[model samples]
Target: MVRTIILALGLMLSVAAQAQEAKRADVEALLEASNMDAMIESIYAQTNKMFAGMGQQLGIKPDEQQLFDDYMNEVTSAMRKEVSWAKMKEPMVQIYLKHYSDKEIKDMLAFYQSETGQSMVKKMPAVTQDSMMLSQQMLQNFLPKIQVIAEDFNQKLQAHRQAK
Candidate 1:
């Protein structure tokens, strides 16, 4: 009788696990509708562009470009492997399920599959890139002002120390 009970419990657990897996798969489909995979891939291309500019800023020699490219490729490959859909699915599903119902998930899927949704997905990378450029420009403009403030503070500290 105990053996039969244990077997029944095992079957129940298996069914529960299958149900959880189905939910995760549903969540994954919703994420795919939003072009999550493409967004993740775009990170690699964006980083490569940033590295090219950084090389110039850091005075990296032309001869070292090949080495940088090789290393960047390997790093990007590792990141791609690490951030695969399987790894992302659990956390994303948890976040989605926490905040959304079955109806909401369906609603989101419908919206994301629409024309406006497609346009947003297509433009997101460029929008993000432009926003980053604007932020960098703003920081560049503010940096000299920050440096001047720091220099003035240092001089005041030196004068105060001498007076003491």
Candidate 2:
């Protein structure tokens, strides 16, 4: 009886492990089909562009442009290394595993392998870029109002601290 129980338990564990591995593979396939690596590259490019704009706005001297560019290049390189798809794939897989079930992942994989899904994947970078620009513009328009509110909050906090 004891040997039978042990054998059964081992079989169950093996089956569970196989299921997990299969799920992980499906999730990986989904990510690949979705072009997540390209998405990460797009994000890196956008970040580099944003940093370049900030450098220009900061009025780096013409002579210092090279220094600023070098610094920005280093920063972006570090970011790319840290956020590369190779580095991120496992964590991203874990996140998907946590949030999505095996069936859901399989469904997504099927969709991503389809023509419509491929089209969405191809256009995602542009859609993301436009959305980011719209959000940034909205934030810029709202920032002065936020600053005023923050200033008022600071004054109130100072008064409260003084009273205390």
Candidate 3:
């Protein structure tokens, strides 16, 4: 009876191991269909564009612009080194596995391999960039309102403190 129990336990463990391997394989297939490298490269490209504007935003003088550019180059290089598919894949896969079932993962893989999915992947960077620009513009428009609210809050706080 003990031997039978041991054999049953061993079989269950083997099945569990195989299920994990299958899950990982599904995750990898999903990643491949999503063209993860292109996604990472798009992010880096957007970062470069953002960094290009930082000097102007900070009002850096012409004389110091070269220095700013050099610093930005170093920053970009560091980001490129850190943000590769290889570095991100394991953590991303773990997150997916935690949240998604094997069937769900397979569905995702199928969707990403579709033509519409390919188009979305191709356009995602531009969509993100435009959305970011719109968000920044909205924030700029709201800045004065935010400042007024803060000032009003401060005055009320000061009045309360004096009363206390």
Candidate 4:
């Protein structure tokens, strides 16, 4: 009876291990279908554009352009090394496992493998890029109001401190 119990426990452990492996595989497949590498590249591209705009606003001299470009290149290289899909894949998988059930992961995998899903994945980078630009423009438009509010708050704080 003891031997039978031990065998049954081992079988259950094996099944659980197999299920975990299957779930991990599905999660990986879903991430692949999502084109995460492209997403990362898109973020890097956007960062470059933002920094270039800042440099222009800062009035970087023509002769300094080379130095700025070189610096940007180094930043991009570091980002690629540190945040590459290969380095992030395991942690991302674990995060998915923590948040999603096995069935949900499988369902997402199926969707990402479909035609509509593929189309969305292909266009997602551009969509994100445009969204970021819109956000930046909005912020630029609103900055003067924020600055005025901040100045008013600072003056009030100074007055309160002096009163104390």
Which predicted model would earn the best TM-score? 4
Residue 9 miss distance in model 1 (angstroms):
14
For residues 31-150, write the lDDT of model 2, one tens digit per residue: 999999999999998897799898778999999999999999999889888888899999999999999999899999999999999999999999999999999999999999999999
What tens digits encode model 3's per-residue C-alpha lDDT throughout 101-132? 99999888888989998888788878988998
Give RMSD (Å) of candidate 4 vs. truth.
Answer: 1.3
Ranking of candidates on lDDT, top first? 2, 3, 4, 1
C-alpha lDDT of candidate 1 relative to the true structure: 0.83
Candidate maximizing lDDT: 2
Off by over 4 Å in 1: 1-25, 156-164
Model 4 stretches with alpha carbons more than 4 Å out: none
- Model 4 scores a C-alpha lDDT of 0.90
Q: Where is model 3 poorest over a 10-residue stretch in terms of lDDT?
A: 117-126
> lDDT (0-100) at residue 83 of candidate 1?
78
Pairs of residues at least 3 apart in sequence or in different chains that clash in candidate 1: none
Q: RMSD in Å for candidate 3, one decimal?
A: 1.6
Q: Write one digit per residue (lDDT tens) for candidate 1, span 72-114.
A: 6887778778977668877888999788876788788887889
Superposition error at 100 for model 2 (Å): 1.3
